[model samples]
Target: MRTQVAIIGAGPAGLFLAHLLARAGVDAVVLERRTRDYVEGRVRAGVLEQGTVALMERLGLDARLRAEGLVHTGTNLAYDGEIFRIDMAALTGGSAVTVYGQQEVMRDLFDAAESRGVRIVFEAEDLRLDGLTGDRPSVAFTRNGVAQSLACDFVAACDGFHGVGRASIPADVLKVYERVYPFGWLGILAEVPPVNHELIYANHAHGFALASMRSPTRSRYYVQVGLDERIEDWSDERFWDEVETRLGPQASAGLVRGPSFEKSIAPLRSFVAEPMRYGRLFLAGDAAHIVPPTGAKGMNLAVSDVAMLAEALTLHYAERDASGLDGYSARALARVWKAERFSWWFTGLTHRFPDMDAFARRMQVAELAYIRGSKAAQTAIAENYVGLPMGFGGEPSNR
Candidate 1:
């Protein structure tokens, strides 16, 4: 097989890039190590930034999202049993996030790919990149135990952090920065109405807890736990009890308890692999960076990365201009770092630290109190929560 671009991974980044490139009249093929069912069924984040929604519309894949997505104009913060709402839409000039699951987004992307003429090769295993530094590059992989090769002009590595994409980058050229938090979030999916209309992030003496929903009938909630925690130890009853306690009285009002259908523990961390672009290989999404879920920036960050990557690749193909491609790394990293900071800050504010002294706890409370009382502070949180403008490198947005 041969194409202008060989995209590795069928995740949001790769699929989004495929759609963007196809719309630009560029020929590309996506390769995934897993089947479409597995990719679409994977449980992931549910928050969608406005830019992500815009891209879905730009790619003509928003019909289902528009119909099923729950839009939130505001989000709530709770500490010391008192809850306050942040008017995100009012603060950001009418920008708000959509509570659409990553699974739904993947389904939409896959459903439209064939009609839109984007090709994807699933179960492509042992993928290898050859001649990345040279103008002529190719990918070698296996499908059904048969060896195959795809020669392409460029490679987009969106296969995620554990995949071969980032590993292919030379050690000397890649620099990694990572912070693994001491705690993890034990979350559950229950078929019950959400306690509140808007999502809530609660900080208590116990830990951090979040109240969220996948739909009007499905609730998604999380409570902070130690890294040593185990899933078997957290029964459905125990989870409900703990989450409600951390949420406190006000936020936990009307909290409904039911049998949890899905439960898992997710570790928190902030990781960034610098120089997102090396030779003809550009890493996107979790392949390049990871933000703690505190600010709900994971998938949104991936969409933004691929948007920039798509623009760079489109410019390269459309105008024979290499400026965008040349500036891709610095440009994408500009936004990546800002998100990293916001996620880190938000995590610190709402999560209990193992080493937190009394003064530190008081400081966290003081900050939250300040944000509650001061419009300026609330404005800052609201803007970051809705996602900063798609302004890369501080110039005007072409998006």
Candidate 2:
């Protein structure tokens, strides 16, 4: 097979890139190692930044999102038994976030792309890219126990964190930065209703806990702890008690225990790779960078990378202008680093450290108090939470 672009991985980044490139008159093929059902059903980030929603709306992918997603004006910061609501819209000039699962967004993108005749090969394995010379690069893979090869003008590595894209790059040409937190989040999705109207980030001496919901009828919650904790070790009774204790009495008021749909532990980390592009291959999404879920920027950042990648490819194919393609790394990294900083900041604020002495704990409490008391501090949090603006580097949206 031959195409204008060979997009590896059928996740949001690759799917959205193929869709956008198709609309731009570019032929693109997507490959996924997982089945369609698995990719569309995997649970992931649920918060969509304002810019993300706007981009989806423009692409005509917002119909189902608008119908099913919930919009939140702000989030609550609870610490020291006090609750403070930071009005995101008020602080960010009417900007707000939508609660829509990444899986759902992927489903919408996948359906739209398929309906439009975009090629997506699923259940394929051993995909490899080689021979970067000439106009068409070589993509080798196996489908249904049969080997095949694809040649494309450009290759997009949107596979994921453990994907081959990063590994393909020469070690000397890359600089990797990473921070693995001592704890991971024990996440659970319950069939019961949510305990709060909006997402809440709770800080306590025990650890950090997040109160978020998937929908009106489903609640998603998390607690910070060691990554080695097994799901079998946590009983239903202990889980609710830990949630109730950390979330305090308010959470207890509306708490309803139900069957847990998904329960897993996710480690916290911040990782970035310099110069996200190499030769004829461009990396996007988790293939390029990773942010802790604290700021909910992982999926959004991936989508944003592909959005820019799509535009860059369009310019390269249509106008013969390499400016956009040349600037892709710098442009994407500007936003990536900012998000990394914000995620780290939020993670540090909420997570308890083994070395957190009495002085450090008091400082954290003081910082929380100042954020609650000062409009400026609240605005800062609101801006990062809602989203930073699109294009290169800019201030977080104040509207």
What is each predicted model's overall lDDT from 0 to 1? 0.93, 0.87
| TM-score of each candidate structure, all chains considered together | 0.98, 0.97
The residue-by-residue lDDT of candidate 2 on 211-327, one tens digit each, is 898899989999887777888988777888888778777645677877787898888889999889888889999999999999799988987898888989998989999988898
Predict model 2's lDDT versus the native.
0.87
- TM-score quality measure for candidate 1: 0.98
Residues 108-136, model 1: lDDT tens digits: 99999999999999999999999999998
Model 1: which residue pairs collide? none
Which number leads on lDDT?
A: 1
Q: In candidate 1, residue 116 scores what lDDT?
A: 92
Off by over 4 Å in 2: 392-399
Clashes (candidate 1): 0
Query: In candidate 2, where is summed lDDT lowest over 10 consecutive residues?
Result: 390-399
Backbone clashes per model, in order? 0, 4
